[model samples]
Target: MKRFLSGFLIGTAATVAAAASVVLTVKKQVIDPIDEQQVAHDEKRKRAMRKSAAR
Candidate 1:
């Protein structure tokens, strides 16, 4: 019984670690780029607005 409990705990910890790794990987590979693109787009829009206002 003790061995089984230990195994269960270890498995749960591993699963949690794996889930966290996946989330971080996705954020780094996918979400971060999208956010960077959004920031760039916002900057471009602001520049265009300033140019139009100056005109």
Candidate 2:
């Protein structure tokens, strides 16, 4: 019973740590760049539309 409890606690800690790491990595690697790129893309599209409207 003691061994089982210890193993369960270890597994839970490992899973939580791994999840936090993945979330942090994804925020930096995937989410941040996508948000930046989307904002830039939207601004570019807006400028193009404005230019066409002016003409």
Candidate 3:
């Protein structure tokens, strides 16, 4: 019983740690400012090209 409990606790801890790491990574991607700026610049450039083509 003791061995089973120990293994269960270790597995639970590892699973929690992995989940936390994944959450942190997702949060960082969602909150990153540089990515937002790059996306906006790309969109603006695309719009400019489309306008020039229409002329």
Candidate 4:
């Protein structure tokens, strides 16, 4: 019983750690680039609007 409990706890911890790392990696690789692109696009759109307004 003790051995089984220990194994279960260890497995749970490892799964949690792996899930956290995957989330972090996805945020770094995917979310960050998408966010950066959106920011740049918004800035460009704002600039275009201002230019048209000026004209």
Candidate 5:
């Protein structure tokens, strides 16, 4: 019973680690780019607004 419990815990930990790794990778590969683009877009919009307001 002890061995089985230990194995189960180890497996659970490994699964959680794998899931975390996948999430991080996805965030880096996919979400980060989108966030960067959004920031760039927002900056561009702000610049445009400022330019219009200046006129």
Candidate 6:
């Protein structure tokens, strides 16, 4: 019984650690500075083009 409990605890801890690492990686990708800036610049250019076309 003791051995089973120890194994279970270790497994649980490892799973939690892996999950935390995955979450951190995803968060970093979502908040990347270069991508965010590029997206903003692209949006501005599109808006400017639309306005020019309307003229």
Residue by residue across 1-55, what tens digits does model 2's lDDT show? 9999999999999999999999999999999999999999999999999999999
CA lDDT, every model vs. true structure:
1.00, 1.00, 0.93, 1.00, 1.00, 0.94
Which stretch of 10 consecutive residues in model 6 shows the poorest summed lDDT?
Answer: 26-35
Q: lDDT for model 1, on a 0 to 1 scale?
A: 1.00
lDDT (10s digit) by residue, model 5, range 1-55: 9999999999999999999999999999999999999999999999999999999
- Candidate 5: segments with Cα more than 4 A from true spot: none
* TM-score of each predicted structure versus truth: 0.94, 0.74, 0.55, 0.92, 0.83, 0.57
Give the poorly placed runs of model 1, Cα more than 4 Å off. none
Candidate 2 weakest lDDT stretch, 10 residues? 22-31
Give one digit per residue, the lDDT tens place, for model 3 in 9-48: 9999999999999998987877676788899999999999
lDDT of 1 by residue, 1-55 (tens): 9999999999999999999999999999999999999999999999999999999
- Measured by TM-score, the strongest candidate is 1
CA deviation > 4 Å runs, candidate 2: none
Report how far off residue 34 is in candidate 5 (Å): 0.8
Q: What is the C-alpha lDDT profile of model 6 across 1-55, one tens digit per residue?
A: 9999999999999999999999889878776767899999999999999999999
